[model samples]
Target: MPRPLWTGAISFGLVTIPVKVVSATEDHSIHFRQVHLEDMGRVRTKKVCELDGQALSQDEIGKGYELSKEQTVPITDEELDQMPLPTAKAIEIVSFVDAESIDPIRISDSYYLATDGQVAAKPYTLLRKALERSDKVAIAKFAWHNRERLGLLRVREGAIVLHSMRWPDEIRSPESLAPRKVELDEGEIERAVQLTDTMALDTITGFRDAYRDALEKLLTAKSEGKELPEPAEGGEREQGQVLDLMAALNASVAAAKESRGEAGGGEATVHEMRPSKKATAQKTASRKKSTAQKTTAKKTAEVKKTTAGRKRTARKQSAS
Candidate 1:
């Protein structure tokens, strides 16, 4: 059993469910260590105070807030505890809303809420089932990492899950990021939607981290004293966006159909919209040229062998 990150009670009106918060996810990303290149020794870091030019211990560190150009205020943990806040030690349920009403973009970190002990299981299961049956999520507030956080509480896999969320003001407008807009055609949109449907899946079951897998294989080969495979050639170059949206859309739809093995009727359409056949012919010609070169080399080797045999015979006859 993994240790709980936080032990707290969920407050809802007159109900309190004692629960432990556990992280719901793990980082699978690869990590590396900084080292001295000459000796392969791990590099080390230290926390040095800028004023005294000395390494400082964790206990000597203090939190300060800058008020003005040269004015600052130091805050302590005791002082922070004295401040009045409702979400300091409890998950306070503020409101219950339809889950679909909340945008998923606002959600951030995830945590699982498990009952602390056998005695707390009843209320925990009750709340979980209630949220599941009602088809709603509870908006709650809690204090964590010295700040108040808004969270969404919902049920998942017969357990309660909490998702910390960003405030409305934190989300930026899309228009602010992309000021320029291009007009879209209805026919192009229809074809694009059709292409999307052709490539859609109920769930992403085939996805894998190819880079990680290749790195693992490389490390295994190094340990086994084996040679590494040659590096692959560069991938195909990306095409620029087509100004003729209809042609692009038709090509995309045809390509998607072809990928799904439904291109029997789309072959002509795909060729009409794309110059793919010409590219294929060029590739075929290059392969044939390579084969012809190999055949010519083989014939030259045979002719040299025949000429050497005749010269040997002529030398023997002259000597006799």
Candidate 2:
């Protein structure tokens, strides 16, 4: 197990549960270090004082706030520790709220809260069971790294997990990022919904990082002095190309269905839009008017032909 980042107690109404905060996630990403390309030597960064031009050691470094270009305020750890903070050494539960009420964007890093010792087991279990039974998360305030931050406490797999959250003022307004007004056809909306349904999955555990896998392969090939792997063959859409929204949705639905091994691998199932009652009525009226005009023209032509035949017969009788 990893070492605890912070040791504190959860302060409920009248109960105190000593707990240790440890990271709930792990970093498996590959990291690179800067080095001298020609000599293959590790390059290191040094901290030097701007005025004295002397490199400083870790012990010589301290926290400071820049007041201006030429002025700074030095702050000592002792002074910060003495500052008055109600949640200095405890996770003070402020209120309980439905888990769905918290905006996911506000949540950041997560940590597991483990019971510190045997004495804390009972209260820790009590808090976990309470959260599970209530089906709600506890919003708490805790101080760490000389700053107090908002946190969310909830039961996960019979253990309590604390998720760090940003303050309300820290979140930026998304109104400016919203797109301009646009019109959508009902058929297009239905096709988009079908695409989503075709691509839906119960869980995301099957997904893997393809980029990381390729990176690992590159490293392995370099270590073995082998030829580098060739790039995969695929082309992206051309820039500034006008796309048909309905056609794209149809193709997407077909592709998703094919990937899931569903029937009709190559064909897209389109939901045709039903015509409005007024439109249907107008079309019917137009057809009736066209038929009536054609019938009248046919009757006029027949009458003219019959009159011409009668005139020719009269002329023949007079000649006789």
Tell me the spans in candidate 1 whose CA falls farther than 4 Å from its real position. Answer: 179-181, 222-225, 234-236, 263-320
Quote model 1's TM-score: 0.78
Report the number of the highest-TM-score candidate. 2
lDDT measured at residue 198 in model 2 versus the true structure, 0 to 100? 89
lDDT of 1: 0.85
Clashes of 2: 0
Mind giving the per-residue lDDT tens digits that candidate 1 earns over 123-216?
8888888898889999999988788999999988888999999999999888767858778778878888888898898889889898888787
Model 2 over residues 127-216: C-alpha lDDT tens digits? 998998899999999999889999999988888999999999999999999999989999999988888888989999999989899999
TM-score of each: 0.78, 0.81
Residue 292 of candidate 1: its Cα lDDT?
Answer: 100
**Cα RMSD, each candidate:** 11.4, 13.5
